[model samples]
Target chain A: MIYFDKVTKTYLDNLKALDEVTLSIEPKEMVTIVGHSGAGKSTLIKMLLAEDEPTTGSVYFESVDIHSLKRSLLTQYRRRIGIIFQDFRLLPHKTAYENVAFAMEAAGRSDEEIESDVPYALELVDLREKIWNFPSELSGGERQRVAIARAIVNQPDVLVADEPTGNLDPMNTYDVVQILKKIHDLGTTVILTTHNKGVVDSIDKRVVTMEKGKIIKDVKHGKLTL
Target chain B: MMTSMKRILRAGFLAFWRNSVVSVASVFVMTVTLSVIGSIIFTQVTLQTTLAQISDKVDVNVYFVTTAREEDILAVKTALEGLPEVAATEYVTKDKVYQDFRTRHENDSLTLQALDELEENPLGAILNVRAKETSQYASIAQFLETSDLLKKNETPIIDKVNYQQNRAAIDKLAAIIASSEKIGLFVTAILVVMSILITFNTIRLAIFTSKDEITVMRLVGASSAFSRGPFIVQGIMAGLSSAVIALAIFYPLTYWLAPFTTDFFSGLNLFSYYVDNFPQFFLMIMGSGIALGSISSVLAVRKYLKV
Candidate 1:
């Protein structure tokens, strides 16, 4: 579960990136955040990840204030939540298996555990066949799948996918969306941000729509109503 | 903990091997820096050896009158040897001095006949005093002038102290040694600092290419240490390789330069010095390489680890 208590983020030029926004997500909920570019979707995700501090208010994971945690404690907290990016920010030099295993390794997993679990995570994302392929060798869709596998390999309590499908084709996007739903059904809270209307419509779960740094609508089983 | 360490090392080797061009560039730059350091060491040693030879050629000689008692002259030699500034004192007997003078003018028959016709030997016993440092000769000369050992029964027994005659050369040599040392140290410091900066910037550029990977690692819940460990390992590898390369370069370099240096420095061989002090040189070069590489990597990776 996560809570944003009237969080606001202002840049140097007094531009409000997040303007007194408040939201909450329950455990095991797959919430898709939909907004156009510069609508504060990524800013909200960054606040949750503690990559950016809220200017005026607190962002909390469960009961602890995420931004107030010490560096070591923050790292431990982040380990419980895996994140993927639009760029599929995999280390280009590593293969699909190594990329996924890297996340597990960061969590201090044993070699035996990585050897066993990495393949399973890749299978979950339907990327097991390309396990040994480097990012350069993989197609864009396969790379996104590897990124997805990496994000969920550690079995984090929450998965944050920031515009993960932004660089994928429609078919690949659909596959990614399906994989995200499957991850949610397997009892993990999922937080996804995107400008794609079809992604929100297909999810058919909770949707939080943003406009000009403010959350304009929150709907249960909602459509993309921008 | 073992698992993490193993993973970090594996990641480091992976990155190092995968980015061969960058790794090679880093090693090359590090080798150049280390070679400069090694050269500074060799230069300093060679300069010191040459300076020591020059210092050895200059000393104060005391000539006593033939009438001066041998016991008095011997006492003077003992006292001069007691001074900390005096490195050594060679006592030449009056008979030996007379013989040396005869031998020198053997080809000049007229001078030899005049010396042989003399009723008594005129040459005095000499006490050759060498100072530990060229700068200490003036003080030693002053000590001889003021010490009571040169006088017996309130009369001066010594004929002459050659210090005043050699004072100009001694003073100039002292100045040369002092200034050369200072300038050598200054130039070495500047060169070392410049090389370190260049090496650091080169490593920074290499890490700059991986700035995005660092962010991704941080976001994936890797601790700062986890993300930083591999780069540190990579740096250490570059350092080690460069050290070996630099040392390898020095081997043939010192060997080829040895004959010329021996000829120029009056038998001080560069190759022999390198071989004799190989262990120390290895430690210095290796230590410097490791420190430079690791510190630079740590600093360069810090900016991107914030994510």
Candidate 2:
């Protein structure tokens, strides 16, 4: 569903975030990208999100060059993908329901759809009881769940979790991982980036390992390794 | 489309309330700027009215010789009245001038005695001339100097003209008012530019404070319209609230100060003036407030909205 054709990104001060890296992912696949802090994982995700342009070559979403689309079209295109972050990134003022509704609102979903889908999506993340709680009122795990609910509310085709469990406790981390596995079972292509070896061992999914700016290994049902 | 608009507007209001401190700070700055502008406008109106009243007090009086015939003086009056610059001309006979001099000197025994000592009503008949404009007085005086009444080959039908005696004060007043108006406009321009810059910076700071929220919005697949709408709305709210606040402050101020200003400035009622032009003032203050706020917000968020 996505392709990176020899993409390379170079900074002005001679830093290469991604160098001649080429990769692709199929549909309905749960893939984990394991990397150290400066292993070009964030840069790779930025290219996919079109938040940063590749210095050379191209990144494509379903055969369409992602960065070549105009701003308005890109926004429309982004609605097809949902992103989760380590910070959860929920609007501090909004309740869980409003936060999910916000994502649907951004996607131009109907009020009827938002009112109906928000609860279902919140229930999916086991946040139905605390749907009225603001981000500040929720625990880190609950906040991340709210973020996940927001991501899936629009029923995006692709789900991306960027260090989704980085801030959670052990139990919360397990709950989050299980939720990602459940989302994958529901047939959404899930691409998660994490450096946690324990989290990777539990998943037993496809692993793409990176070091520096290049991918070193790609294995189906793989274990995390340096 | 309708739902989207409602959502955007609601989100905008929510954003405004969510960032209440910044919103209040922006409104406060806006109120100060608008209040200053309003006060400047009121002062300009009051100053113009007072200057106009003062200008009316300035005129030249042409005194004719005591020996000059009443018909000759009447002819001079008719001719002076014919001039385009002369707004009015009134003939004051020697008898009336003597009477006026006596009445004016009633408080001083020495002045009354000196007036009485003048044998046979030595005071001359006078033609009081008023110009259409204060600046026209100089030309009117020059016109009179070259007139046949002043240079009558023999006994010159006119005596000394009192224009030179009053010219200095009138010219000085007019010059001062003109220069002050120029200065007032220059200062107003500076204030306007400075206020805009202040508002711009304040809004920039407000946006900078919200950068985290903006980034989250972008990351969650929010469009520019969705992300930027709240800030724009917040800005407009700040502007509108400030305008209302400024009006509330200025209305009472104008009313309370009206009596004092009327008394001090010969019945120039600022309260009435403000009330009469209230709709215009409302539009000006509110329109500028909204413009200042929205433009500043739009510009401040430009760099951050790239996502």
Candidate 3:
């Protein structure tokens, strides 16, 4: 239930990061956005996450227009959508369980709820055994899993995996892909962007390819045919 | 709101513990600020005590001529006593002055021989006058100067009339002390402002280091209000710690240091002064701590919580 209609994003330096791009995602669908570097893939998700605004057209998450939301209410809207970064931006000071619980805490979940749901979220990401380990103590695959746990901790309607497995080795990448597929199967809208051809082809989901600032192709039940 | 407040407070405490370097540094800055303020408070207390002591010893004694009639002089003393400033007055006859002087030196034979050789008593009759306080001296002196009954009557056989010889110097010193108080308060206020700025900048750096956590808080749904609480708490803790520390450091320092200041202020009872005003000093220390802590926290949190 997310839509972007004729969206154009211009950075402060007049960089036309995205231009006249129109796209929509229905409920419970997994869409993969594929592009090379500086291809506006990140800008697309950044707009949806309410981190950046469209320069010309509107971006909508469900019924609310993101561009005009006041600063106070913006966080309320953003916490509904989970995003995992390329760096696996888990708080280094926090343990795996605490990282997931941090999400619930940010959402103002009660102590009892955080205590219950954080462990459950970690278990889902197969990080139950690494719950007490800090990010530095964990392997790259495990840290990514911790990030996934934080992303899904609040049971967000949509998950944007912007190069979620970018830092992982092949085996860990495969593991992360399986986690995304499992999350998608459980009925969360999953949006992934990557130039990793192997992971993209293996997913066999709907794929959208971008070049410059425009959406070049959209294929359902498709390969990573960029 | 209640739930959020609890979260903020808990988070603030956790953050303070986790960010030890920043916390300790902030606390140290707060200590320095409070200590500076503490010294101001100490000076105010001791100065008041010294003023009170000066006032106790100060009296305006108007001396009359040796040739003045006892009756006329007594009448002048009565008139002087009528003035509102006069606390007490006594008539000192020249014979009594001579007699007391002879009794003291009579035991010393050489001084006794010199005293016997002098046929006439050189001492004038003294009007020993005590005023309400040294501050009342000017008004009392004004009254005596205007009293022709004491001043203009050659018939009264009056000669050079004078009060205490050292009143002028004492009065001048009192004026200097009063002016210095105003200047002291002004200087202390300036120092306070500088210290607060120092404290604010220090705390700001600590908050700046946690920029990533701040961004993460926003992404995870923490309100701008919630994110600010920890830094504010950190500032308050610094202030509070500074308050306690300054008192702990200053109390003993005052004890050892009071005696050293004897060179500048002879016979100053600084040790007793601190003992008497300890309550007031404690309050000042606490107030400085809270001010530095809360204001610095506000500055830091306000800047970073713009999300």
Candidate 4:
């Protein structure tokens, strides 16, 4: 369970990135955030990741304030959530398999766990055939899938995807969306942000739309009504 | 814990190999630094040996009058030898001095005839005194000039003390040795500091290229030490490799310079010194390389790990 109660983030020049935004999602629920550029979608995710602090109010995970944790505690806290980016952010020198195993290794997992789970995670994203291919050798779809495998390899409680399909072709975007659906069905809480109308309509899950820095609409099992 | 450590080490080695160009650059800079340090050691040794040879060539001689009794001369010699600054004293008897005089004139008939016409030997007995340090020669000479044994019975038996004539040369040599040591130390310190700075900047550039990887690692929940471990290990490997390269370079370098150093430094051979003190040199170069590499990596990686 994750909660953001009345969070507000203000940048220099008094620009409000998030304005008293209150939102919550239960465990095993998938939520889609739809907004144009500069709609506070990434800022909200950043707050949840503790990458940025709110100017007012606190973000919490299961009743624990995320920003209040110390350095070591913050690392442990972050390990509970998996994050994917539009860039895929895979280490260029590592193969797809190594990239996935890197997450498990960071979480102090043993070699036996990595050896068994890494292949299984990559297989979930249908990237088993390109296991040893470096990021440069992999296609954009395959790289995003590798990023997906890396995110889920450690079995985080929450998966956060910020514009993961922003750079993908239509076919690749569809594939990434289907994979997100499969992951949500497997009972992991998913928070995804995207501007693609088709992605929002296809997901048909709880949709939250934002304008400027405020959430203007919240619909359960909604279509892209923006 | 062991698993994490193994992962860190593996990642380090993998990154080092994957980024070969950067790794090579770092190693090259470290090698240059180690070489500079090694050169300083050799230079200091050569300088010390040359200064010692020059100091050994200087001493003061006391000439005794022919009328001086042998017992009085012996007593004076014993007294001069008692001083702490006196390293050694050689007594030349009157007869030996006469023999040396005759040998010198043996090449000229006129001088030999003049020497042979004398009833007894005209040359006096002599006492040669050497001091432990060139600077202490002045004090030793002063001690002899003020001692009561030379002016006994209201008449001086000592003909001349050669210290006054050699004082200027001795003082100049002492000054040269002191100033050369100071200059050597100053230059060495500057070189060492410059080398460390250059090495640090080189390692920093290598880390800068991996700044993205560091951010990705931190975002993926890697601890500070976990992320920093690989860079530190890479630095250590670079340091170790450079140290070996520098040591290997010193072997042939010293060998090539041995003849020149021996000729210029009065039998002080650089190659022999290097071979004899290989262990000491190895420790110094290896220790400095490893320390510089690891410390630079730690500091450079810190800025990127803040995310």
How many clashes (backbone N, Cα, C below 3 Å) per candidate? 0, 0, 0, 0
* Second chain TM-score, each model: 0.96, 0.77, 0.72, 0.86
Pick the winner on DockQ between candidates 2 and 4: 4
Q: What is the alpha-carbon lDDT of model 1 when measured against the actual structure? A: 0.93
- Each candidate structure's TM-score, on Cα atoms with residue i matched to residue i, is 0.98, 0.87, 0.80, 0.90
User: Which pairs clash (backbone N, Cα, C closer than 3 Å) in model 2?
Assistant: none
* DockQ, model 1, C-alpha based: 0.82
| DockQ-based CAPRI category assigned to the predicted complex of candidate 1 | high
Q: Could you tell me the C-alpha RMSD of candidate 3 in Å?
A: 4.7
Error of 3 at B230 (Å): 2.2
* lDDT (10s digit) by residue, model 3, range A65-95: 8888998778888788887888888776567
Model 4, position B215: C-alpha lDDT score: 84
Candidate 2 overall lDDT versus native: 0.89
Give me the runs in candidate 3 sitting further than 4 Å from their true place: B43-175, B261-279
Residue A12 of model 2 has an lDDT of: 94
Interface RMSD, every prediction, one decimal place: 0.9, 1.5, 1.8, 1.0
Ranked by lDDT, the better of candidates 1 and 3 is: 1
Clashing pairs in 3: none
Where is model 1 chain A poorest over a 10-residue stretch in terms of lDDT?
A: A102-111
Assess each model's interface with DockQ, reporting 2 decimals per model.
Answer: 0.82, 0.60, 0.45, 0.72
Candidate 4, position A118, lDDT: 98
lDDT of 2 by residue, B1-307 (tens): 7887799889888878877888899999999988988988887888778878887888899988888888888888888888999998888899999899888888999988877786788888998898887878888889888886665566688777888998788789779878878987888899888988988999999999878788778767788877888889889999999999998898899999999999999998888988999999999999988998889989998889886
After superposing candidate 1 on the true structure, give the runs of residues whose Cα lies further than 4 Å from its correct spot.
Answer: none
lDDT for position B100 in model 2: 92
